[model samples]
Target: MPRKFYDGPQRDKPRENCAIFGVACDDIGYSVSKLLYSGLIALQHRGQEATGISLLETGGNIYTYKRKGLVSKVLNNRVLSKLWGNVGIGHNRYATTGAKEYSSSYYLQPFHFKNNEIEFSLAFNGTIPNYAELMKKLEDMGRVFVTNTDTEVIAQLIASLSIGTEDWPEILRLTSKFLDGSYAIIILTSEGDIYAMRDPLGFKPLCIGELKTGKRNLYFVSSESCGIDAVDGKFLRDVKPGEIIHISHQKDIHSEMVLRTNKTAICQFEYIYFARPDSIIDGVSVVEARMRLGMYLAKKDPILKNSEITDNAIVVPVPDSGRSVAVGYAKEAKLPYIEGLMKNRYIWRTFIMPGQNRRKAAVKEKLNPIKSVIEGKDIILLDDSIVRGTTMRQIVQLLKERGGAKRVHLRISCPPIISPCYMGIDFPTKSELIAAKFYNKYGDSYIEEIRKHIGADSLLYQTKEDLSRAITKSENELCRACLTGIYPLKSVEKIREIEDSIAKSRT
Candidate 1:
């Protein structure tokens, strides 16, 4: 097995960060900041390391505050009251920086840029994998930068070139040309405009909505629909990938959909792990997708085949991400839903834990089986996806020994992730993935081999067809690259070569 930093007998691979949110308004009377807090809390699963909000008041002034903590801990009523504005954008971040300093810096997001002439702050949901190349381009142009964020990269690009142009579309066009990786950003400025744009691939999620007061309603944009629902906003639909939305009090609302490339490559992990269960992305309900995933797995895996999974079998979910899927599975498979795992609400995200050992310790402390819920019952364990089997194995052992489960049937809501994502998600390379490792050693397919190794009675996984069908839109409208290996952009030949060899895939 390819050893990872957090792989001991009881350790598991680290969890990936997820989630992003943005909101804007025209009037100053509303508690827009509090509204933003509600939205961020609902979208917290997308990211937990840091939470931030940026506001642009009516008087051409922008204020922003962000740090390494949860949304509630970082911003309270006192903090929100200090920054007064009708227009704002917020972000919850997952870490991409390898260093502890990079992870700990409060200066990371809603990354603000100011000069004698202009000022702006931005919060983004996706990654720009070619940020190194973009930084070189900016440095060549004499634009100085303070932080190591792709959010900063775009801010500098905008600050340097926005000289004579009052046009937001032109600014976006100039910036998008230099970026070769995924980015979905919200830009707030001294000029009272908030700009939201998804990359050409739609590798991140962004949506539009309206919030109603007594008389008139206000318009806004966000990464997920639940954020809008937090402030009593009704969802309109997803912002088209490769489109930019410009919102302001005075100017006519502006929108433009010009792509750096023609193809759209939305992230499959969003449907499987990132987005909130209540919110729909790209017209697909995340809750429904998870339900379908369980049903599909039931049809494919031997453990579920011909087994009378009635009210006797207890369905338990890995909390937060797996909750809705567990509910759906329990309902559809005619099983009893049991809240068996008790998550430590006090535990910080893996990104916030000071070291690798702390994160590994957290996985143990974060979940424990409720002995009463699983005593002497067959347990079907549901999780969003299993990265390395170490955590799953530990979790299963807990069910068998501590909770007295008769048998453990493992269920995953997504297909075996045979490839790493180059866009925004932070999954490790395939060499470290358990499914890939099992396939390599056994010289066979992954499903059965992984089940046997994990000590599960049987295992079931969602298929590419189930993933696609789970989305209401046509198959062509979604991105299944991680499962299908159909990358929509240019690949470093060596990385792709290694990925193909490890998966033993023909492509």
Candidate 2:
């Protein structure tokens, strides 16, 4: 009913970019909208900027409801009542590209495109690094685009490819050959058919699940296993890399390996920061992986094991993202683990807040030191990763200057981020990364310099080998491109160019 698309200014943060959810049920009476709402709510952490859902009715009419906001705010009971169907697809979006204007609702997906011949709604998670080139090719073929976002480009491309064939899997396989980056996308057609597909390299996460109600069985495809858990569904395995899964109106499911590659590049950040702790990704529990990271960090750093340090220092997590690893570190180091900093539950993530000033203010507002716990004590601070270093520096200053911490030793769960990410997690340019900037400025003394900059007594980062071990995956199987500068895809030059353009535009 809300036809007006609103656009607002953009923010920079370590974003998962988006989350996609889809379900098809054999029972027409099943409330697919409610199930989609539950699944999207479970994945709310993946994206808070916007939410959308597309439903296909039995008579071949497609309905979509979407708006810019949190899922709870955007999709209410009244809205859900309007989105009726046995099959539906949903999306939670955090803008990875395009202008963040109020009118940008045009970009909010499950994007629907309709014509006399065919119609479908698409929701996608992940970035297409070669979007400009792909868009250019489509434009050359006389395709018109309304939104600047890559989702529209992808949707149009799929529509164009679907022209000659009803074999959607084959069309997707052909589409996969032209796409050069990460994506896990779900599509709902007017005929009540749903299709889910992942990129060839598997840079993003997607999983399948099943829920049984009476005589009807419902199938789900989501960005994480937690979505399935939210709906009380049985956990099924991940959608294989380069696989296309189809769910028909009859609730029959089929999967095809449309693309194949020997190497898979699951984004490691999904374990370290992006995913819910309760979620299992790529056969690894995110919570356990974080704990292993702490154990590995403790084994690598003798200071954590030093009795003197452990006796006087209290292990404190940076709150939320750092909690799991801090607990792990405390156990391995034989130190006291305490909530030395209390997070203000009301505030949003500082990194996602728009502008440097707002981000700084949000960090101060979001975290407050427990003076009685931290005062006159040595503090071992555990955090997931250091991006811009602004928030970390602020926290160090808060603990020392305000809370009277004698010393602050910082430990990160992942290796230093030296390269930009193109697959969707938003650390787009080396220039915007504190580690890369410090490395460029201080050369071999970068680590010490960053420690000095953050006012930490000492700083230690996990090694790449240790990170791989922590996730229980080989280095080649993960996308550590941001840490090691070796991208899984061969579009490094193109990604850099795009990132540079983005950086300049931000300025």
Candidate 3:
């Protein structure tokens, strides 16, 4: 059987950094390895490039297994059987740092660090914006670096701090002061304890869940609640921003607020695209938030209200991610919701494919028009968002030419992604964004210009206000940096450096 759930390459989607899962149980009766496997499976969508797990046995021994493959491929029955323990942590990695071409395995994580005093393994999700600076500081302190990843830098920092103190939470608090990025990390120590920490800004999501088995209790910490749900655990709540949760071997869970800030900057992309629709993060349902975005878009559409389009006009989802939004839009617009495009379950995500030719070919094989549903109809095509616009352009062409659609109108669920995401998302430079390019070329008429470029009769996006409202938060509380060009972190200099580098590459 193939390891991947979806075969075709992804189209116009931002890649997430990674997913982290950790669990601590009262006894060895439960298979902690198997539970970690289940949790990683639920988070497999967050990353597919690499998977790992670290287990702490009863006798203060820690074993780690990791490789460059999907979770399904890396953790087979034979592999899980060897990882016997009551406490463990797992990771699914999508590289946001380190060169993929140079010894990639060195960067694959559930990174283990050991010294005469302590031993611990870490699984991290999110990027460290000040990675070079911190790594240099550690290097100055005589720390030997093996891998080029920020995960290793963090592990070494913790090890250096553990020398003089046993208070892991205090060490983490001090570590937090030097870090400037988004991160949710799980640490599994040789003492059979697990520690989960989220960044001060709450740029990433982490949640806790509980499983009660008669006389025993099991605790889980994961990047998303869906990981807990996969193991049949009950979700307790999200770990507060800048909180350090320590789950001891005795099944005691304690939390410390190491860093306190007046505001949080949770990545809006989680609700827009990164997370599973079934998962809830920070007290909001991702699916419900997207549905609200569609409703808002439908309510504000002047064309829909004026009934200017043909009577046969229909709402068609781009498939998968766009399905919920299309349903919501159809409900509000009083139009029929139809699956006009059929996706091939066997094709791999196009974005992960190596070459442009291969990616294009995969896209062609991945989706085919449902002629009966789309022929002779005007399509209100709903998609999550457009990144480079290559996929959307091809999709628009396919719908109009092959599906025989009279006209196509594009509705995007979020505002124009005019800037790059600096947290953990893959859009590192504005030059790679179609919206940014269009805005540069067309000035005030970028929307209309992008519509023409995509061969759509009309193009509309959810306003910034609607997007914030749909997520049940004010714009000030969310990370609208990608859309508004306002970064929440003190990394404006780094953003400019990246933009400058990208411009140089293009020239």
Candidate 4:
């Protein structure tokens, strides 16, 4: 097994950065800044460290504004009123690379690139495992970069490809061939056009939509369908895995499927935890997928066969992310569903907190048991997945010690995560994952060991088959790399070798 190369405490669940959004209007009568703000707010759950936007004024230069704060705080009325444009792009970011503190604005997006050759604004989701190799290639060509981010490397690559042609789609097509990681990118060119493209593997989600207000038409590109709904736009469809979509004032929406592959590896975490329930990805509804995961859990649970446990038990979710799954479990098992936990609206998500102690302390501050509903009752607690097991252990203790529950049965919607992810999700190293640790030592007894470690009366996890059936995608069509130690990208495999060698050296 390999240890993490990065030095620091890590969060328990998978966290991804960057939600890209762009809007293009047919008329200048409307400013797109407010619409951009609304779209970002809808996708805010995807990122929380920073927010930014770049707007192209009609017959004027592009203006960029960004800072380290939430979308609501960073893009306030005082700031949005000054940013006037009919075409613009926005981004919400939680860093997986470069600086995590977000102290400098240059590290944020939409990365406004301005050089002697071209000018454009870029917003991006997903990670590039081969970015360092591409950066070295550009450095050899006499390109200088200010930030150590893949976003800068991508901008420089596009500039290099634009030396002979100004066709935005052609430039992006050439740029995509050089990239070897998962990404969904939207670019706003000075020509007042927005170009959106998904990677060949489709590791992230991107969609297009349109809206009509009076006689003007508006087109949007967003990381999720929820953003389009936030602006009252009707979702057209998801961008094809290797497609480049062009939205402009001069033409109907244009699309070019640049690269074709037989298999795609869409991240499975989108269905389990990442995306908003109201959003749909790749023709599958998020809420429906989660509910099906719960149904599967209910079908195979051996403990449910005992009438004594099922008789006095109530199904309870771990707040927002687990609510849909709890609903399905209750419906399938014929148990009463109860909102046994009350969440504090003001606290930040404990899942994203840095240290184990801080996250454990925040768990109590963030959620309190409704003692009246759960007292003297057997509780079936549901959550998305168990990562490091720190939070789950704390929550289980909280339920028994504070809520007076007779027994706590912990149920997880996804299978045990045994591997790290290189495709944007911030899963910890193999050594740090609780399931991975126990599996290495106990083999087939890992689940029982985990149940004992977390202080749960019993534990059950959704099988991989159930996960695939719930999402309605074949095993090859989804990225289960975190559940199984296989990577789809050659660059990520090489990265694994390097990290393994580093771990061996330290040992």
User: Whose lDDT is greatest here?
Assistant: 4
Best by TM-score: 4
- TM-score to native of every candidate shown: 0.87, 0.93, 0.94, 0.96
Clashing pairs in 3: 7-347, 7-348, 8-347, 8-348, 8-349, 9-348, 9-349, 9-350, 10-349, 10-350
Q: Judged by lDDT against the true structure, how good is candidate 3?
A: 0.84
**In model 2, which range of ten residues has the least summed lDDT?**
1-10
Off by over 4 Å in 4: 1-7, 97-102, 351-358
lDDT of 4 at 433: 90
TM-score of predicted structure 4: 0.96
lDDT of 2 by residue, 1-507 (tens): 111111223233366778999999988876699999999999999988889999988687888889988999888988887778899999998754444353466777889998766799999988776787888989999999887667888888888999978888888888888888788999998878888999988889999999876788999999999999998998888988899998775847788665789889999999999999999998999999999999888888767557777778999999888999999998998788899899999876555566767876787888889999999899999999988787898899999987899999999998988886767776635676789999989999999999999999999999999999999999778989889887888665665667679878998
Off by over 4 Å in 3: 1-11, 96-104, 308-310, 353-358, 495-507
What is the alpha-carbon lDDT of model 1 when measured against the actual structure? 0.71
TM-score of 1: 0.87
Model 1 stretches astray by more than 4 angstroms:
1-20, 28-31, 98-106, 251-254, 258-262, 304-312, 347-364, 473-475, 491-507
User: Which sequence of candidate numbers ranks them by TM-score, best first?
Assistant: 4, 3, 2, 1
Residue-wise lDDT of candidate 1 within 365-437, one digit each (tens)?
7777898878887888888887767667767877887778888888888777766666666666666678767
User: CA lDDT, every prediction?
Assistant: 0.71, 0.84, 0.84, 0.89
Each candidate's clash count: 3, 8, 10, 0
